[model samples]
Target: MRPKIENITDLRGEISRLRVQRLEQEVELTKVTARLKARLHFPVLVYTKISDFFIELFGDDPEDLNKKKENKDWVTNILRVGLPLALNRFLFPRSGFLMKSVVAMVSQKAAKNVNKDSITGIIDKVTDWIKSSKEKSRKEPRMADYGIPPDSETY
Candidate 1:
């Protein structure tokens, strides 16, 4: 009877150990899944890619056309801010006027806030909104309300 009781105790300990191991494995799996999702859903790489495109298009070289400083600033800002904003609107259509109003208020607040950190946060939010919008847009096909442009071939 003593030996039998010892054996049962050992079996119960093993079962408990196995349960702990399984829980650890499950936690690790969750971490891995979360990391992968962060990689896919975040737009840090997308922002860099867009920035590079704009730089390549507008950055000056000795052999390139002489560009004005003000023009360059305008182009840079447009690409940095306007492109993402427009893309967001095109892709994720909330109420057009509502979006406009919110963006306008955010912009005004950012400009007036005068705090670097606040502005940075605001900009980040704007970029995220744009990225999400574009992702939504890419999933849908455009309607053919307007005729295709001349000098262009449709595939």
Candidate 2:
């Protein structure tokens, strides 16, 4: 007989693993945040207007940028966790890929939980992650040295 993939215990196990793993990724997240905070210069400690980053990074359309700016919370929350998770995925391809998968599963359920209070919580979490990550890296590095800037041939 074939094994079933729908075990409740397995799902819970995966979620617990993801939460712990996400916490661990907090270290690299700090590095990325320090780079961004230094380069972008957003007035708020947290990078609240994340669409600007996307536009600067990708050369997105002006109308799309404005729309994204209007729906800023959605952008902030998505980028808050998604950016570091993405960078980690790029740097260490074998890591916590399953957490991204799990987030996909729970995200719809999580949408209802996205209230004003929850947005505040997301902002706090992202800001804290950046601050903690920056503290860990004693000295800050330049973005140009990393080749992630305006006139770079590589992305």
Most accurate candidate by lDDT: 2
lDDT of 2 by residue, 35-139 (tens): 988877755634456646756788888998577556546645665566555655675466576765565445533543454666688899999999999899877
**What C-alpha lDDT, on a 0 to 100 scale, does residue 109 get in candidate 1?**
36
Instruction: Kindly list the per-residue Cα lDDT of model 1 for residues 38-129, writing each as its tens digit.
Output: 99865877877986786688775634434333234433444456544664477546667767757654654343324445557889999999
Task: Report the C-alpha displacement of residue 31, candidate 2, in angstroms.
Answer: 60
lDDT accuracy of residue 115 in candidate 1: 42
Q: Highest TM-score among the candidates is held by which one?
A: 1
When summed lDDT is taken over every stretch of 10 residues in candidate 1, the lowest stretch is: 65-74
